[model samples]
Target: MKSESKSQHVGKVTHHELKQTLGTWQLWGIAVGLVISGEYFGWSYGWASAGTLGFVITAVFIAAMYTTFIFSFTELTTSIPHAGGPFAYARHAFGPTGGYLAGAATLVEFVFAPPAIALAIGAYLHVQFPGLEPKHAAMGAYLVFMALNIVGVQIAAAFELCVTLLAIFELLVFMGVVSPGFQWSNFTKGGWSGADTFSMGSFHGMFAAIPFAIWFFLAIEGVAMAAEEAKNPKRSIPIAYVAGILTLVVLAIGVMVFAGAAGDWTKLSNINDPLPQAMKFIVGEHSGWMHMLVWLGLFGLVASFHGIILGYSRQIFALARAGYLPEWLSKVHPRFKTPHRAIIAGGVVGIAAIYSDELIQFGGQTLTANIVTMSVFGAIVMYIISMLSLFKLRRSDPNMERPFRAPLFPFFPAFALVAAVICLATMVYFNFLVAIVFAIFLALGYVYFLLTRHQRETAPTDALLEE
Candidate 1:
């Protein structure tokens, strides 16, 4: 039998280890899976309520910032090339405290997102069965993916690829129906609300939109989490980041335009599941087919939850490997070679969110806003911290070699950071209950940070598995 290496895989006493390395395509699929959640259902609602110009401008900024941010992360991921990408990078550059903060914030961002995606799935399901219980739908959705994950990592990765393909097909179909209705006049009729929060003047509206926009663009960095699994981390990971961002950007622009032209921007604005409503208005009685389209797109979106759970599971595994989290969390299955414990942890969170919402009647209560805002707000905090880390790393570790550098150096990261802050301000300005909930999460992370600080310091070297 092959002897196990002396390197500790974090605190847990385990003979298991990570299985096969992921290739470029799989890495890209992970990134796509993360951001694709928003494209299918979230974006339309966020942008539609604003006028045509509001939607278009928001789309433009989202596309631009995301493209630039992908490039920035490409550099960071390449420099670190670890499983827990940002956390690993932050730790290496800024030490354990910074790493913990980044990891904690990211954990909150990713963990919170599954619920948002699951809830969206529940919403889409409600279209077919108007009285469908969200809790049951969410639980069902979570259970299906959790089972797929328990099957093994390869299945989870392959599933993500399938989800991406299906999402592409769904978007193309949506574009086909709505693209023809595109009218330049629609875009010229309205302007952004210009609400204030971050920036100095009239652009406050744009600034305020920043946080939610960041939320929408949050998952594009999934390449980092699966970096260790990549067949060739240096090549495939970068390509995936770039390709996924480009594809999402183009698709987002198309979707925004399509959603705008399908009907009056005014009417589509308030509907959370806007595509179905827009299609209903456009195709009249044939809206059933449109509903079918939404249902199909929703399937792809839900499939993404499987990929997300997989990505985050590995992150927790990495965290454990680094001795920041419990060693048991970092354990890979001896046979399946997947991080079973981390997967379970993530699954628990996903199901719990589903179950809690069911019990509290979250959709029927004021807490619905709390649930939605929590994810958005968490993402905003993570994005801001990640960007800030970038600046700090540049200053502190000027000598660190960057295989893939952020284009325009300080300028792009600076701008992206500003954009992220602006988005958070917008959420607050809009009085989104989600923002308040996000503050609560941040406070929670802070508390967790303080609690974990001493433990991290005293963490034994044996707890860190170098391999």
Candidate 2:
């Protein structure tokens, strides 16, 4: 048909054209970089719902979910190795519709995650400098990081590696400084709420803490989105993915346990920087330890903030290149060899998301909480579709080359899928407002794609597989 021919006008670029500059360390940088901020804040929100013990219970469950999911997901990322990530896998297995939904979920995940970190960055600075306001500092962070992303990716990735290293160092230092102040009594004083034993409130609180637990490792999946630019994706991705998750699990457990022990657990809950606040217990507020954490801790935020910018940019570029979004968004900068347009687009949306709720309040929910839950909602959907894609591909394309196979096969992904579904359901029930907002965002995106679907001119990035 003429329509099909017209749509075919959209073109695809060869892999050699995209520029493969990232190596194992850079890949590791991006993987952990996109998630290290989770160690800084947001996890403490769990304490507001479920005290220390209940929060730990929820954290343990979610950690298991991430550990299993990452193993199975590595299989898809290695075999397909496309920038679209879940979108590519779903499209290869299902079709355009499946790819569109997966990309949208990815968009939701990467797009909203950075702004929450931006706010935290602002909060950290505000604590140090009384004159600077949190909102202004947050918007300023967006400006600075967005420009750095536009200048170059190698620069960005190198910076990501440095900050990631710095963040790891900061955590190590935090543990050492706080260990002397850590007492078993602080952890158990209000360990269980409502009853000395277990209460229904704490039970409900544990599930309510799911989103916060998810925060500790939220954007780790974003490592796959940079596949097009990785020098040797097959070798680098699996190592980065596995190493990143294991590091986060240890840091999450350490920071939570030590932080609770350092101070009144309840006081540390829902704050911008629990570690810095907890440090005040030993080193006075005016001490060098407090000053060091406040300054270096910015690296943790920058690592995630800068790295997730890389993620959402790639997601935008991938979506645009595949016809899920506008074509211009996919074009790489000639000078920088990075998706500058996509980076700018993501920054614009993120800044708007930062201020949007301010103009219209919703149930006293902070913008940070709403965005985090909504991102998790998208993550949950992506997990389900991606796992389904894994199974579907196994059945549909039995001969495909997979460099790294999941250890337990179907069992790992199946357990991850179940856990993802439960987390999704819990978010919808407890955080209905954000869930509805996320649904509305998805509907609007789908409707736009529906209107433009027939006119889009794009071919599958891996069309040779079928040919």
Candidate 3:
């Protein structure tokens, strides 16, 4: 392996590689933390669109998609082990244009996700202190986490581990606390999109709920973005991804079900602080349990918020190193050996999005809901391209060493690919205006890529392959 400081030049682009400092546990922490915030909030919006029963059906379908997607995506991550994640796979499979589409979609997914998490952090804080503006708290979270990420991957990942553990524990406590109050009647009331039985309306609601259902495991794929930073990616990534997905599936279903049954399901839907608000139904507004939930809930939001800052910075650094973005953003900090410029650059974009909550609205959705849908738009696109890349590589590079092949081969990847296509279509149908906004973002990014074509350097296929 080359030194972290080694730079390879191609055309006008130079790559500044990230250090390999992460282990299996740190990778697991990151995999879970990156998506834990969805459990904290953002997902309850599904209840609003699909009703509790309808959303459960939506969530089950999406979970199956992610389960297959992660298993297949791990193959590409272990084979390439590049910080570019899907970009490297797509580039190797279909050349520079494929890389650009995958990279742009990934950037949108990672960059937009943090602002929504930050806002949720603010909302959690606002519950404790009513006078604090959610946007102010959201902006403050970005600054604090960005600094932590800029310091180093090890420290950032360690913090993510601690917070993720706490968040997981708190969620368990929540289920136990509310379990006594749970009733079959409350859960079934207005369950099928406010109808007595399933109908076309119920199906439409389920389709509309796709994005929120997706929130359950939105950025687990981000574990791949840290492939270059892992001590032994082929071995560690598989363990982390497999364990992370199982843990999340159990937690997502438990949290959603228990929260719904604790009280009137409708009240828990469409709110940023659903857990605490649901707890208030059982423990009362002034109870100690309610206070604990309000405080500990921040850990869940923080885990995802901090971990994603780590995810987006690595992505920005990779994109810049490959000349898809400005070269200056690729510079690693000399002392910390981290992508400081990329961390701060992503922070700027997220902070701007935090301020835009009031300025942007689509289909009468809340800022968090709209942003979640937009991020899912990027995610579904990346998933489709990534699965295609997996198939392409299998056919094009028959002899490539694969330490961890996706189980069930074509069956697993094909299932994931088909599900991702269905999700993208459903999301676009329900979120047409937000889809336009997402398309505009991609169009602008593609235009930038075209203008800088002469400066771009595609990383070699064998550059980061492990021995």
Candidate 4:
């Protein structure tokens, strides 16, 4: 009893306050910037598993899931408005175990995603400077962006807004430059897993491509993680989330369809730098337009990589503050007011993953593809738990002050839940080894939680919920 009291005292002393500086536009920037990198690179990997048409079909299905999920999820984000995002909701709904599950999954998603983006950043850089190793460029990205995030949220968000806008502009330019080259035949040729029509193999490929389809909007929900930093979270969060998702859905489909239609789609299917490569088919490798893509494309990758560093740091800090991680990690920077230790800690893990690209491979997949799959596994798990939390909260805390209620109550959340479950099942079936690795990661975190359960202080959610 004495030790427990001491532990509680230790928790009470840890600083967890964050500056409430973000507004609606900044929040929207973070929401979109957190995922703009998807339009730049990662989604093309889906075209490898599912053919162009199959991947398009897969993308559409996943977009529907995100549309529903974001609308439903906004209610929870605004209601809770905690830095822990899904973790806060799950904890309130299903207690500590649920919180741990959601937190661990969110950590995995945010952490693993950057290394993949880092690699794509490297690949894009390699196009400009033939002598630079992609991995080295990836490492440099980790260092640069992590430091930017450590500086401060206002500075970081402003940079994110700038880069995100630039990335969007570049993508529009890419579409226009490639439009004249687009042909229906180029997009449809071998569109169904190399088959003329959809078959059982096409179905399997489509299911297998779920992870990459998810990549297009993987971190959009991360805006919720910034809610506590928003000036008026209740109003800003809904506007940010709703506008962000719509913007991404339009950009994602346009980029994918345009890039695919601009070339022999299969050639772009298996590459990290698909857009620039597709542009080369029309504009030639030395064309100013192709060079512009290679340079400005960095903005998209930078936006996501930098924004996610902001995100994962908050998760780490929130988890640490709640006693789910080491207490020292919860420390806030005195001057910057940023979670300095948490930022560095997550950066260490990401750098290690970036270096492990060659050493870690499962089923002949590139580290980028494998990590993408792993990240998606965590994302799907979190989505399921969050939706369940929404349902649980409505029943258990019916009187809870909800700023925004999910439209089509139960149906929207229900669809998001079911879609997430299906995506998880299909992803696990296709990428069983990566699934095992992801499960092991969660299991390890859970074991630590169990061992330290007695020492944990009251979670901050209790206080937030009371308010």
Candidate 4, superposed: residue stretches over 4 Å from native: 1-14, 357-359, 458-462, 465-467
lDDT of each: 0.67, 0.85, 0.87, 0.87
Against the true structure, what is each candidate's TM-score?
0.85, 0.95, 0.94, 0.95
Off by over 4 Å in 2: 1-17, 458-467
Model 1 — TM-score against the truth? 0.85
lDDT of 3 by residue, 1-467 (tens): 12111233323333476789999999999999999988988789888878999999999999999999999999999989988899878877877678889999998899999998888778767867899998999999998999998888899999999999999999999999999999978888999997657888999899888888899999999999899899999899999999999999999999999999999989988777789888888989999988888788889989998988888898898888776788788889998989999999999998998788566565898787777778889999999999999999999898998999999999999999999999999888888999999999989988897788644634322354212
Listed per model in order, the count of residue pairs whose N, CA or C atoms clash below 3 Å is 14, 0, 0, 0
By TM-score, how accurate is candidate 3?
0.94
Q: Write the per-residue lDDT of candidate 1 for residues 355-378, one digit (tens) a residue.
A: 674443442333344455565665
Worst 10 residues of 2 by lDDT: 1-10
Query: What does candidate 2's lDDT look like per residue over 166-274, in tens digits?
Result: 9999999999999999998888777765234677778898998899999999989999988888999989999999998998899899999999999788888868778
Query: RMSD of model 3, in Å?
Result: 3.5
CA lDDT for candidate 4: 0.87
Provide the lowest-lDDT 10-residue window in model 3.
Answer: 1-10
The sequence of per-residue lDDT tens digits that candidate 4 reaches over residues 33-145 is: 99999898778878887999999899999999999999999999999998889988988888778888999999999888888888888887887798999989998998888
